[model samples]
Target: MEWLDERKMDRGKKPGKLLGNKNSKNHMDLQDIIRESALPFLPAKSLRRFTGVCREWKLQISTPFFAHNQSYSFRDVSGFFCQSPSGALSFVSLNQMAYGVPDPSLKFLPEPVDIRCSSNGLLCCQGRTGYRAYYICNPVTQKWKKLPETTANHGTDPAVVLVFEPSLLNFVAEYKLVVSFASDLDGYEFEIYSSIDGSWRISAEISFGKMKLLPRTGVHVNGVVYWSSSMGRIFSFDLSCERSTIINNIGSSSLGAVNGKLHTACLLGSKLSVSELSNAYTNTMQMNSSAKQWQVKHAVTLNFSVPDLYPRSYDKETVLFLGGDVVVIRHEKKLISYNMKTKEFTEVITEEDTYSRMVPYVNSLVEI
Candidate 1:
């Protein structure tokens, strides 16, 4: 393990005298207190390196309380995990100096798995073979847990989403895996697997009549899981009440969440429009369904032509909402990020494979 050099630390700010004494015990205690308070703001990689500083620091850093505080303090988009159609996986770093993993392809898992969803730092993956088991893992720590099988069949390609929100009071990592699959009798059924109880239970609610949820478009906001549908609707499943609600008239667009608020990005002829869903959860419950829920947040016309960027019948293009100000769009073989605030276009990368899925990742210390 790499350790921070003492000489480098000594070269920085020198401590002033406390209680009129430079080397007094009170002065050392004040310094230690300041260091402990500032530790939670650092990255997980830096915290791991600082563990080698002393036994007291290691003990404090290894505690669950510290992990919880650090997770909330450093909640920035570290990078993304890109998975191709052939189950090939890769990592794209938003900032290489601050965030990364030991293995981007996730070779630490027991077998080959396809990543379904990502929340905070945990990844929900389904095994390619055998029972198609579900596994929740932390890529940074390389720790994973294989969940028990669900009562409902997830079909061949169901919409799977992982919901995990770190609590300030609760230190243990609790999460849920929601699967929206075709029902045996009707439209669609929801089966949720909870990590707290280590059990799976099929929800009593199902989708509205004949609605087919688009696979791989599930986004969790607040306590509800939202997915765009092929029938021009947005299907949302509330985890708190275990109920399903449908929001109509939302056209073809990609779903993303920023700071617990839901947003959508849609690409039209040479113009990219981004809209925010106001009163999303509350308005869905009201009987007056005629009120407009979507508010146009940002819309900018592209300087270059993107005539071929439209979705075809066979293959659909994707728009990714990265952080608060940037939206990434996959155009043919290239991935471009457009800043809503600055109105600048930056080419993230060029990929040979056109059918790649990108899931945003945040580097966290929450143990699995």
Candidate 2:
């Protein structure tokens, strides 16, 4: 392979040398093994460059099967797409060497968009102008699909969440968008848009009592979508059964998924507490009984002092649990991450203005 020849030249070796005769079956078998084992593990950018080595490499890398495998194997929180209060978007790389996007501001899209939610590598954005249309896009591949307008009215500030899970058994990149909006009757209503059907449908289940679902607080775990409410309650909707239920209150906190389980992170005084919802899926399906309680997972006190870190009003403070160990805290204009395992605190970035939204992103090749 030409990629191998480049590596050989870097090591001061002859470029044209081969392990054996070019037509040997054993040589081809070794090459196939290497491609199968290593190609999926590489970052999407490297794999894109490797496609130019030869037609065989291009064919192998472009397959949907390869993209599915690569999506699962290379899935990690690369960084966040942060949007300032003035609607300016920027990308902050957690590790610049390992991960980044070609266009952080998402200029490749048709119009300026406000990112509503992100799952896996796909981002669900709504057009800033012109009827406020919705769009699903993959930043890595620069591929996008605009969805047909929903029958239900998703208000100016909608409670939208995107759900996309990559599976080994399924190669198709399928996802769903769940929007909670005001209902004509008494309480809120849910309207879901599935990529499989390419249409929006109003769920039979409706009304989460009088609690108002908070915008931009939806988190998907397993097949269920959860949203925090202003009344300190949790509203859950199961995509499989199209049922909605209310989980027990856990006060005002941020929700995230870690190791396929639902977790909540809240700042109390000088300490940051992380808790997991044990038996989340099972409890979410059963609407009658009370959902499982949150078990304390990690409670790290903020030893270092920062101005107004634990302010009396927590409306601007946000906590996000990234991966399994790091807890990201956004206080005012400072973005800090605390490692649960290492017990270390690192300042990720300091923004010029306060950010209104920070969506964690993963670099993926999933086609829309």
Candidate 3:
């Protein structure tokens, strides 16, 4: 018993010392506390503050027993703030499209102006530094690699850029990286990159004059990137054979062609669908895969559409939706969310709307 409490005094001569008895009991209690805290499942919730308790506490917290609790499964940043499949919104960068998602969480990539959603959350991103010269980025984890600047160098230039992933289950899905660069000014050069060797190869020239600036949101399907140009041309690039071809002109000059940015979401059942914004205010468009192209499938009305033609629907500062849709829409100070399958839109919340002079802005919503 004395061995268990080192602070115990030799009480043979000093009968019963109250102070010594208290000290001995306190020493045994310290040992009991240490033993109880060593259990694996027991974790210190306030490990940071517990570390400042004393040097001993810090050492214990740093140990494997305590440190394990510090790890969080997911933390999303800037982009759309939405919960992951597991419902953990720890850290995420939802700001600058796919380019802004930081390291450890995603691949370091250049600023991509346009991005296409691929199978299993993978993205084909076209990021450029100067006029028409661009690199490619993947949004699955933000991995990126720069594509060759010159495909032909024939004084032609690429009017638009796109990246496509063809397969869903396998990494090497018959598809590859393709870009439409230097079409005329740079020499109508079509370039392709292989996932196996990481090389860029040029395809046979599809001679054409300066390409009409069309909607750059190119959708990838059946191993090709499809886009409708302002000059009224439907372009297709084959990833497997590394080829470029022109398809029949689709859509119409009569219908209001949204000059801003177009988004395409492909469906699986039968046809293709896309999300297009036409004459709508404060509504971030979600296009389905059933129309001639991706036409508006879901619409959320705004209190003020006004003249903000260049509508910044995705605000980097706010996490709109994380892995999935976080909001349906925001009117003035109120925010909303929607279900992708039910085709139903609902208001999630209402805020002060200070940024737009009380005008209201809900860029993107993702769980962080």
In candidate 2, residue 213 scores what lDDT? 80
Worst 10 residues of 2 by lDDT: 306-315
Alpha-carbon TM-score of each model against the true structure: 0.81, 0.80, 0.39
Give the TM-score comparing model 1 with the true structure, all chains together: 0.81
Query: What root-mean-square deviation over C-alphas does model 2 reach?
Result: 8.6
User: What lDDT score goes with residue 270 in model 2?
Assistant: 69
Per-structure clash totals for the candidates:
0, 0, 70
Per-residue alpha-carbon lDDT of model 2 for 136-235, expressed as tens digits?
Answer: 9988888999999889889888899998988777677888999989999878888989889999999888774787887877889888888888777788
- TM-score-based ranking, best first? 1, 2, 3
lDDT of 1 by residue, 1-368 (tens): 12456655655534443435755777788868856788877667678878898888899989878888887666666667878778788887655666678888999999998877788778888888888999999887899999887787787777999988877777778888889888877778888888888999888886657767777788898888988777777888888898888875346677887656788887776778888888555454668666568888888887655665433321365566544677887766666778777887766564446544677787888777
Clashes in model 1: which pairs?
A: none
lDDT by candidate, in order shown: 0.77, 0.79, 0.37
